[model samples]
Target: MRIILALLSGTLFGAGLVISGMADPGRVRAFLDLFGRWDPTLAFVMGGAIVPMAIAWTVQRRLESPLGDKAFSLPETRGIDTRLAVGAILFGIGWGLGGLCPGPAIASLSLSPVAVAPFVLAMFAGMGLHRLFTR
Candidate 1:
């Protein structure tokens, strides 16, 4: 049941991304191009993305356990660190340049127009290297 709920949640998220025009790199790029196109659609999409997570956090805080778990499986770290800084810098640079992060990049992969495949592969490689080096 939990697995099914997870799948359903993911499907809903991906569908929301698609419907919000966030599944397109062109749209994302336009959003970043403030001096040029300056799309406001991304703002609305960000609001949509945040609302559910915010609500989930609020609800989970009130719960002792979730679904089949004895307790929530949450992040262990709560401090600022080199890993966080480096990741943020790299993410900001890539986002400013390409206008897509892992989630949207994966969502946009359905376009399969040859450009996004390399970006997604490089993203995976970067993530792997981050884990290996950080450890």
Candidate 2:
């Protein structure tokens, strides 16, 4: 049941990415290109995403447990640290360079493997390195 819910959620998220044009590297890169051909479409997408997320947070505050989980396992972190800063910087660099963040990158894999493979590989490598060092 939980696995089914997880799969459904992921599928919905991937659909949203594709429908919102987020799965296109050129669209994402244009959004990041502030001083260049700045595209504000992704900003609208972000704003649209935030609406439902905000409502979810409100609902979460009223619920003891999620529908598919025994309890909410939310992030407990509430501080700005070196690791956080470095990770953010690294993420920004990767996004700017490859124009693909995790969600969009993963969603794009089926559409454009030749372009998405390296970014996905590097993303996994970065995740593995972070776990290795942080642990």
Candidate 3:
């Protein structure tokens, strides 16, 4: 049941990305181009996401446990440390250069497998390296 729910959720998210043009690297790059021809579409998309998430957070606080889960498993860390800052900076750099963050990159894989494969592979490699070095 949990696995089915997860799959459904992921499919819905990927559909949203594709429908919103987020799966397009050019669109994402345009959104990031501040001083250039800036596209405000993604800002609106993000704003749309934030409102629902804010509501979800509020609702989560009122619940003892999420559906089909023992407890809500959220990040325990709540500080801006060196590792956090460095990770954010690296993520920004990668997003700016590749024009596809993890969610959008994965969503786009089926659309352009040849082009998106490298980014996805590199993303996995980076994750592996992070785990290897951190441990």
Candidate 4:
């Protein structure tokens, strides 16, 4: 049941990315292009996400356990540290360079597998390297 729910959630998220034009690298790059022909679509998309997320967080405090889960597997730490800052910096650089973050990159695979494959593969490789170095 949990696996099915997860799959469904991922599919919905991917569909949203595609529908919102987030899966397009050009659109994402335009959004990031400040001082140039900057697009505000991504900002709007993020702003739209925040409302639901804020509501979810509020509801989470009242819930004993998440639906279809025994417990909430949330982050244990809530601190701004060197690792977090470094990771955020790296993520921003990657997003700016590739014009596609993880969610959008994966969602784009179906649209242009040949073009997106490298980004997805590199993303996985980066994740592996992070785990290897951290562990």
| Model 4: per-residue Cα lDDT over 14-110, one tens digit each | 9999999999999999998898999999999999999999999999999999887999999887889999999999999999999999999999999
Cα RMSD of predicted structure 2: 1.1
Model 3 per-residue lDDT tens digits across residues 60-125: 999999886889999886889999999999999999999999999999997999999999999999
CA displacement after TM-score superposition, residue 64 of candidate 3 (Å) = 2.0
Per-prediction TM-score, please?
Answer: 0.83, 0.95, 0.95, 0.94
Off by over 4 Å in 3: none
Error of 1 at 134 (Å): 2.2
lDDT of 3: 0.95
Query: For candidate 1, lDDT tens digit of each residue in 25-129?
Result: 788888888899789899887777688889999999999999856778998877989868877898989887776788778777766648788889889998898
**Candidate 1 off by > 4 Å:** none
Clashing residue pairs in candidate 2, if any? none
Each model's lDDT comes to 0.81, 0.92, 0.95, 0.95
What clash count does candidate 4 reach? 0
Candidate 3 residue 58 Cα shift, in angstroms, is 2.2
For model 2 the local lDDT of residue 60 reads 96
How well does model 2 score by local distance difference test? 0.92
Better of 2 and 4 by TM-score: 2
